[model samples]
Target: MRAEDEPDLVRVSLAADAVFAGAGVELPPDDPRTLLAHADRVLVATASDGRPCGLAATVAIDGHPHLEQIAVDPAHGRRGVGSALLAAVRAEAAARGHGRITLTTFRDLPWNGPWYTARGFAPLPRPEWGPELVRLWEAEAGIRVRPRIVMAGRPG
Candidate 1:
C-alpha cells in the first residue's frame, strides 16, 4: 500500500465495518492510519477509480507473518477482493521464508471463520499457541465480547 492509498483504504475498512454493526456487533473503533503506519506489511486491492476496496495487513508473531486485519468495502464484498488481498499477504509471507500465516477472528462469523477455513486455515489449538499468540488472544478478550479463535494456514 502506498502513502496515497491511505485515505481510501481507511474509508474502505470503515465501510466494511458497517456489516458488523448491522449484525449487532459493536466492534471497537480502529484507526486505519495507525494500522497502516504500524503494519509490518500491507496489501491493497483497488477499484478501477484507483481507490482501495480492500486490504490485508500483517505483523510478525514468533517469526511468522500474522495477519493482523483484513477488510473489504461491503459494496465490493463477494467479488473476491478480500481473497485476493489475503492471497497477496500469504504470498508475501512465503516469500519472506515464513512457513505459516496466522490470524485471529470471530469464531462464528460467516465471513470471518468459515471464510478462512475454506481457504485452508485451521483452528490452532490453544495449547499450541506461542507466547505472542497467547498474549494477542488475551488482549482481544478484553475488547471483544464475541468468541474468537486463532487460525493458522501454511503459506508454502
Candidate 2:
C-alpha cells in the first residue's frame, strides 16, 4: 500500500465497521485509527479504479504474525476482498518464517469467528497465550463487552 492509500484505507476501515454496529456490537468509535496506527504490515485491496476498498493489517505478537484488523468496505464485501487479503497475509507471514497467525475476534459473529473458522483457524487454549497475548486479551476486555476469543492457524 502507498502512503497515498492511507486515507482511503482508513475510510474502508470505518465503513467496513458498519456490520458490527448493525450486529449491535458497539465498537469504540475511535478504534480504526488507533489499530491502523500500530499496524506494521498492511495489505490493501483496490477497486477497478484503483482506490483502496479493503485492508488487512497485522502486527507481531509473541514473535508471530497477529492480525489486527481485516476490513472491507460494504460496497466490496462478499466479493472476496477480505479473503484475498487474508491469503496474502498468510503467505507473507510464512515467507517471513512465522509459524502461525494469531488473532482476537468476537467468538460468535459470523464475520468474526465463524468466518475465520471456515478458513482454518481454531480456538487457541487460553493456557497457550504468551505474556503479550494475555495482556492484549485483557486490554480488549477492558475496551469492549463481547464474547471475544483468541484463535490460531498455520500461516500456510
Candidate 3:
C-alpha cells in the first residue's frame, strides 16, 4: 500500500463499519491513522476502476501474525475482495515464517465468525492466549459491547 492509499483504505473501513451499525451493533470508535501507523502490513484490494475497495492489516503478536483489521466497502461485498485480501495476508504471513494467523471478531455475526470458520479458522481457547492477546482482549473490554471471540488458523 502506498501513502496515497491510506485515505481510500480509511474510507473503506468506515463504510464497512456502517454495515455493523445497520445491524444494531455499535463498534468502538477507531482511528484509521492510528491503525495504519501500527500495521505491520496493509493489503489493499482495488476495484476495476483502480480505486481501493477493501483492505486487510496485520500486526505481529508473540511472533505470530495477527489480523488487526479487515474492511471492505459494502458496495463491493460478496465479490471475493475480502477473501482475496485475507488470502494475501495469509500468504504474506506464511512467507514471513509465521506459523499461524490470529484475529478477534464478533462471534455471532454471520460475516464475522462464521465467515472465518468457513475459511479454516477456529475459535481459540482462552487458555491459549498469550500475554499480548490477553492484553488486547482486556483493552477492548470496555470499548466493545458485542460478544467477541479470538480465532486462529494455520497460514496456508
Candidate 4:
C-alpha cells in the first residue's frame, strides 16, 4: 500500500465492519490508522478508478507474519478483493522467509473464520500459540464477546 492510501484505510475498514452488523454481531468501531502505520507490510486492492477498496495488514509475531486486519469495502464485495489481498499477504510472507501466517478471528463468522478456512487456514489450538499470539488473543477476548480462534496457514 502506498502512503497515499492511508487516508482510505479507515473508510475501507468501517465499510467492511458492516458485515458484522448484518450478521447480528456487535463490534467496536474500527480505526485502522494506527495498525496501518505499524504494519510489517500492508497490501491494498484498488477499484477501477484507482481508489482503495480493500486492505490486508500484517505485523510480525513470533517471527512470522500475523494478519492484523483484512477489510474490504462492502460496496466492492464478491469481487475477490479480499482474497487477492490475502494471497498477496501470503506471498509477501513467503518472500520475507516466513513459512506460515497467523491470525485471530471469530470462530464461525462467515466472512471471518470461515473465509480464512476456505483459503487453507486451520485453527491453531491455544497450546500452539506463541507468547505474543497468546497475549494478543487474551487482549482481544477482553474486548470481544464472541468466541474467537487463533489460526495459522502455510504461506502458499
Top-scoring candidate (lDDT): 3
What is the C-alpha lDDT profile of model 4 across 101-126, one tens digit per residue? Answer: 99998988888889999999999988
TM-score of each: 0.95, 0.95, 0.96, 0.94
Model 1 TM-score, all chains together: 0.95
Report clashes for each candidate as comma-separated counts: 0, 0, 0, 0
What is the C-alpha lDDT profile of model 1 across 72-144, one tens digit per residue?
A: 9998899999889888887777787888989999888999999999999999998878899889888787546
Candidate 4 stretches with Cα past 4 Å from truth are: none
| Tens digits of lDDT, candidate 2, 37-142 | 7899888889999899999999989998999889999998899999999999999988999988999998998998999999999999999989999989988875
* Model 2 worst lDDT run, 10 consecutive residues: 28-37
The residue pairs that clash in candidate 1, if any, are: none
Ranking of all predicted structures according to lDDT, beginning with the best and ending with the worst: 3, 2, 1, 4
lDDT of 3 by residue, 59-89 (tens): 9887789999889999999999999989999
Best by TM-score: 3
- lDDT values of the candidates? 0.88, 0.89, 0.90, 0.87
Instruction: Give the higher-lDDT candidate: 2 or 4.
Output: 2
For candidate 2, list the clashing residue pairs, or say none.
none
Q: What TM-score does structure 4 among the candidates reach? A: 0.94
